[model samples]
Target: MTTQLLSRWKRSAIGSQLCLDLRSPQAYQIRHVAPSTNIPWQQLSLRCAELPPKNVPFAVIEPSDQKPDTCSQWLIERGWQCPYVFREDDDTFWTAVEQYSQPTTPKPWLLFRPCPFLMQHINWIEKQTQQHRCLDIGCGSGRDVAWLLSRQPLWNVYALDSLKGAVERTHQLTKNMGVHDRLVECLQAKITSEGKWKTFDEDSPAVTAKNNTTATAGTSPTSGTTTTINNTIAITNGDIDDKSRRFSPGVSTDTFFQDKLGCSQFDLILTIRFLVRSLLPQLPQLLAVGGYLVISHFVEDGVHEYEQPRKDHRLQLGELAALYGSMANIEIVVDVIEQIEDGRPVNSVVIKRTGP
Candidate 1:
């Protein structure tokens, strides 16, 4: 398409269209776009006639790392009026010079494979899944969600990530792929830590008269602590019962997070990067009798001071899966994955809770 038309095509305010690299006599052709009439850059002298007329103000997007000036020079010599130039555009024609040269895909590149670390889990997802009530808990770029949805558009999916940027990006990706209504449920809720929460003072002059806000649940601002020295009240929900409870406050669904995922409970819960101990125990309860829990993260070798993941709030040992192994009704398949990134080897574990 002409550059003018390309620019006018609304940015979609979504995500960029991702495509395979194309080069030479043939290229990665989409169903809608015709086969690109591409010839090697070296033959520009002979290939000049194959291009558009000289009067057409054509535009070209060069791979930021490739040679654009050289290609522009050749086009000019052939009487082509190529008036526009772009230093970076990974999704488009890249000077036509790199029809064969492919050390890698262009920069700011998304992973060619979505679930690289857990191919087994992906395969299991494809084979064992009866319904596509899939939830990608930490979908970075919607790759897995897109891949699965494209494989089965009828399946229901909830794509979520903690990072707002990633959630929006995934939402855009789903929209761009025409799966907005099928596989896109972008949310910003985060996994609450299992750490103990204590109440803080809610009284003193800071307590409002008009707002009608008071100490909720198990906590009310202590009178003596109003000086900010001795006051202590725990985090409480804005409910009568909340004021009665003293610990693990907040409007968190620590008990039934999975039930609130969708209509009932998601058949598949995909989590990466985040970890919580209490969540692990209830995961089995969240699933239908035969629901699957697929998880992957970096594992510790027992050498670290704490059995904690290096950066994220992930598990240290691969025992989190084994934590539920004692339950005979569930099938626990847990093991360490291959080391491909900068850290120690990762781990992927799946637990399919069965009926007794």
Candidate 2:
């Protein structure tokens, strides 16, 4: 594969293909193929979102000592299409990088837009001077997380997602935006009933922590913060929070959050485009007094072309208002079904935990 890739590079200008140098930044700075982006091999999983669409073909430049097979397999598994692998040690490869090093017009990088609902209502956070904590549930791709970090310098953002890939993408996106330092953590665990989320896979570590703390199985750090795999519970069609009118007392939801998230409460809690009826009861418990909770997703009556949410997952009309309205110490800030330009109706609600 290296020989063939080198042959192709020699025949055509190296500028023709999108090249990703998998070597470390230090090594890449010393010497690397011209017009190549440096993303270390180990960071590839987290930073994979920075790459162009999976359909676009690209080349991988790896360290001379390692086999290109590993790099190729990793890219393929991530849905990245056909990759051309080359080693830095190859004389032909080095010569081609130098010979055809002239810069080519760069391709447009992919753009990620933040959630519109969050953008409109999140103005209050930026006005405050004191540092605050925020939690984003189902933080797919981390657009909102990155936006919050970029917009408010004093806020420490935490992200959660059930999928490992989603967590990785969120981490990488924040890192790319240069706000990763303020990103408290990204948790790869499903929001099961209270403490039901247990580690099912220890082979893959759940998080990268600071100061020797880790979410890997069997090791309980004194800090009470932990991580878990994407283990999920049964999704019921009925609204348990509405029916019960109060969260169950058995599981002790606060303990689960304290141990998993490291913090028992957040100033702002958001779950966008994600619906789990049973999880609704847990949001208020996760919010501190005077903090806000936001929920937005497709509604059952919403007319749209997209499918797969199923009737069970979509929120019923007035469901958000009814559920949170009856709950004590809760105030509904905003509750309405908004229609975007695409004609899709989204049920959005914002509420504040007014009392303990």
Candidate 3:
């Protein structure tokens, strides 16, 4: 069986310092799979040097399982020096399992990003976001929240969730991770929903009604008796002025440093595997003047032959990158990755907003 040969080949490959696979001539011509090759049986005698340094175990994986009995007998009599043969019917499951058991991954905190995607390219982003304040949006069970905090204990974490029991569960999870203090109480606010916060037009009507009644202001000239101007109108020229209307200053995260109940101020923000169109454009503003952003998510490539994105809120391919185009410190991420060094399939990008 092929498994038995691979078992022996894996062992023999250890001391030789080189492992080569000569699979098929056609396969080599088409894709030329990296680290795998095809060495024709007839030409190998003249091309043995074309194979790799014999300093390591050199293997020739051929598609042939049947050979002349005399050919088998001749190779059999040649001792252990003959190239290991990998045939088509060889069941390689056991051999792959044996090789997979070896230690992999840079460290153990990456079980969440456990695919050959995003985490493979995370080193630079990780190094940049570590020491800053961060918020992990859509933190389901706090697994990623815990992983990020575990790497940098000094960083403050605002773990947010919109589910019914998400806040409580995040509390329990972070407590289990022994990082409750670093984690701010879970925010139960829904990032979506137009009614989550009272709209300006809706909120303004109440204030306008109030101002019309009791608030004393310079009166408009009646005609003959009074000739005075009234500039105290709540609506400026029939439009609501953001500066004049009680600007909610809307729950900014900046209050943290002032020892006040902060509105959500963070030096860095992270959202992974989640999308909301309204939130996309505001990503640049969430950070402080010089804040950084790290976002990773599933993006379409415009090629999948399905109904295309149009007149909808869902992000299309390259949409996330385009959102911050005019921003002073914007960096857009593209998903065309060259290396699979990390064990996951991921699309990730880091944006740094330089201070004005």
Candidate 4:
């Protein structure tokens, strides 16, 4: 990487991102970037598996004489986004280091940091079967989507948002995190919209047949009749052709969810800050037997700092729990209404779908 570009990256928000110091432990202990992770160069091969997700921005810092070209090549071949190297002797190296400062507050990119409640119950989640599928409703900027993918690298994650920007941001963020494009599918569309779901042929070039199969397996059994249409549009490196962007699966949210993701249900469904009351009734249909559903959002308390004018949008005390309590198929695992450190009254519930 050029010094100018390196300097620019260092000055930007990406600079505070993770860094990998490839020096020996003793060398790293003596002097290294303030917030970098040390995985000595010689041990990189053994410890490479421990590296963060590809979407995370990271740079490799190595000794002056030992270039990591081979190491970089090895990582890139195994799906690690190749990191830029900074030699110890370079003048720009220290400049980049000097500019590094850990973020004091949570940034938008990190907004989906796992909820403390979820963290407390992480053992419950980890005990579930592997290769699980997850859905993130109102996946704004994909914070939770990214978190889920990072936490369960082998799992498939599907994220949806009504806003185009949010969907695009989720896609971009996941891409930046180096998530395999196949592992995540993002859509800009409302979940409640009614329309006939359309299907694509397995041989269609627009999306791989494997992806189509994965998605199709998730559709609801009652989702009724399907039509197969051959979409000739080509996909390159997981990106649709610009001319065919509008017709691409990424843009076809309804079709993607209804048809491509046919009869499929998720092992985990998450609704964070965003809430659509209409979605509550539909949650059961979307969850697999034994799947968990987590929902957290603002509640209607008189202590309004920033008033949510829409009463329908704000939950009443115990309302969140009641929504699931009435469901015979769901078992409420965790339910609480408390003022977090931020002093906002929120209702949170975690429930498991116990029956069909």
Off by over 4 Å in 3: 1-123, 126-131, 193-263, 303-313, 333-347
Q: Which TM-score value belongs to model 1?
A: 0.53
Model number with the top TM-score: 2
Encode model 3's per-residue lDDT on 1-356: one tens digit a residue: 55565567657734221223334556535432123434445544433323332223344444444452333234345432335554433446324534433433232212122222334544555565534677776676666666556564366777665442445556765564466777764654434332121112225333443343333346432211111112221222222232223322223232322333253456667776566655666667667655667766554544333332232423455565666766666655433422223222234666776664
Q: How many residue pairs clash in each candidate?
A: 11, 0, 17, 12
Question: Which regions of candidate 1 are displaced past 4 Å?
Answer: 1-111, 195-260, 302-312
C-alpha RMSD in Å of predicted model 3 compared with the true structure:
22.1
Better of 2 and 4 by lDDT: 2
Task: Candidate 2: list runs displaced more than 4 Å.
Answer: 1-110, 128-130, 193-195, 199-252, 302-305, 340-342
Ranking according to TM-score, highest score first: 2, 4, 1, 3
- Against the hidden true structure, what lDDT does model 3 obtain? 0.46
RMSD (Å) of each candidate, 1 decimal: 15.2, 11.6, 22.1, 13.6
For candidate 4, what is the lDDT? 0.61
Order of the predicted models by lDDT, top scorer first: 2, 4, 1, 3
* TM-score, predicted candidate 4 vs. hidden true structure: 0.54
- lDDT, each prediction: 0.49, 0.67, 0.46, 0.61
What does candidate 2's lDDT look like per residue over 1-356, in tens digits?
55566557545542345677788878887887666677788887766656645655677787766775678777889787544777767777676567656553232222334667887888864453244789888898887787788763468888887655567778878766677898998976554444344322334432233323224344333323233212223121222221112112233456657776688788898899887677897789888888888888988774565565777778889998998999999999899888643466789988998899
Best by lDDT: 2
